[model samples]
Target: MKLLVTLMGVAFITLATQSQSIYSLNYTMGFGVGETSDFIGSPSFRGVTFEGRGFLDDQFSLGGYFSWSTFYEKLAGEKFTDGTATLTGTQYRYINAFPMLFQAHYYFGTDEYEPRAYLGAGAGAYKMIQRVDLGVWSIEENHWHFGLSPEVGIFYPVGMDSQLNVNLKYHYVFGVENSLNYSWFGLSVGFAWGD
Candidate 1:
């Protein structure tokens, strides 16, 4: 019983020090490409993602994200049949992405409607599945790939732990044999807990 009480106190203290930070889940839909077009489709890529953000102080924040993005490509050199555009010569590329960033936000004023804007940069690695039309060409590129992440976001406080915000992020990778450029617009709804 005494041990349980001590654990409860520790939990309470932790909650007190960590400012109630905001967490969110967002959906990303966009298109992009890199070096080998033979292994992936046109520029139409589809992606879904979830990420979390936490406050380090009133103006500083830290966050991380992971997501899967994929698309299909056609190999035009293969057997041709308009009605039979099968998966025979097409490539399906699936990328698993992980990114972490430290952000600094500037709030316009001391009002509830005060607009907040932030900018930050980070790096990520991708696990890639590369397929080809004539045959299946696949490879997994590890951390040898590095990226630059820049984001601008805004927030409107509703009560405190809740808000509405919009953000734009540009992710450019240089470590891949070919640079993979990805850009996304995010619309988010979120809640803050703890602090």
Candidate 2:
């Protein structure tokens, strides 16, 4: 009876030592730049975003995001019609986008510290809009858009059960007149357990 109990205890300890995991929800703030601002001849567009991440195990994670981006462009050649300027100094467009991505992390070769790298892909939809405003006239065009994304990130443990994560991502949106494309930087906080 004593031997059986001791073996069971040892097995449990070994299993626990080998299988550790973490979970987290992160919010990111970053900016984006347009790929086609040159054609519009306006100021480059940019905006902020928010994202969330969760850990599945010690070396894997799943993430989702919702972001709002506003891009701006300044018109160089201005024209007038009906006493109203055809172009304004700048143009504004906004996108409401969502993305789902998965990542695999590696946490080896460190001095008992947890530092990892991850990569993943994403696909989602966007609510996009374009607007033009003259001194005496204004117009707006709104539609639904979709896109794909690929990203990578690094995670470093900072506390007994928490981590600091840094992410770099790129997205290219299609199905529109001018493609929606940008890169973003993200900082995230997460918590871990087990192992």
Q: Where is model 1 poorest over a 10-residue stretch in terms of lDDT?
A: 185-194
Per-residue lDDT of model 2, residues 34-107, tens digit only:
54343233322344444444444544544445455444544544543565545334433333333322223444
Candidate 2 residue spans exceeding 4 A from truth = 1-35, 39-48, 76-113, 176-195
Residue 174 accuracy (lDDT) in model 1? 57
Give candidate 2's error at residue 150 in angstroms.
Answer: 0.1
Write down the TM-score of every candidate: 0.57, 0.55
Instruction: Flag regions of model 1 displaced more than 4 Å.
Output: 1-17, 33-45, 74-88, 93-96, 100-115, 124-129, 133-144, 157-160, 176-195
TM-score (C-alpha) between model 2 and the true structure: 0.55
Model 1 residue 109 lDDT score: 42
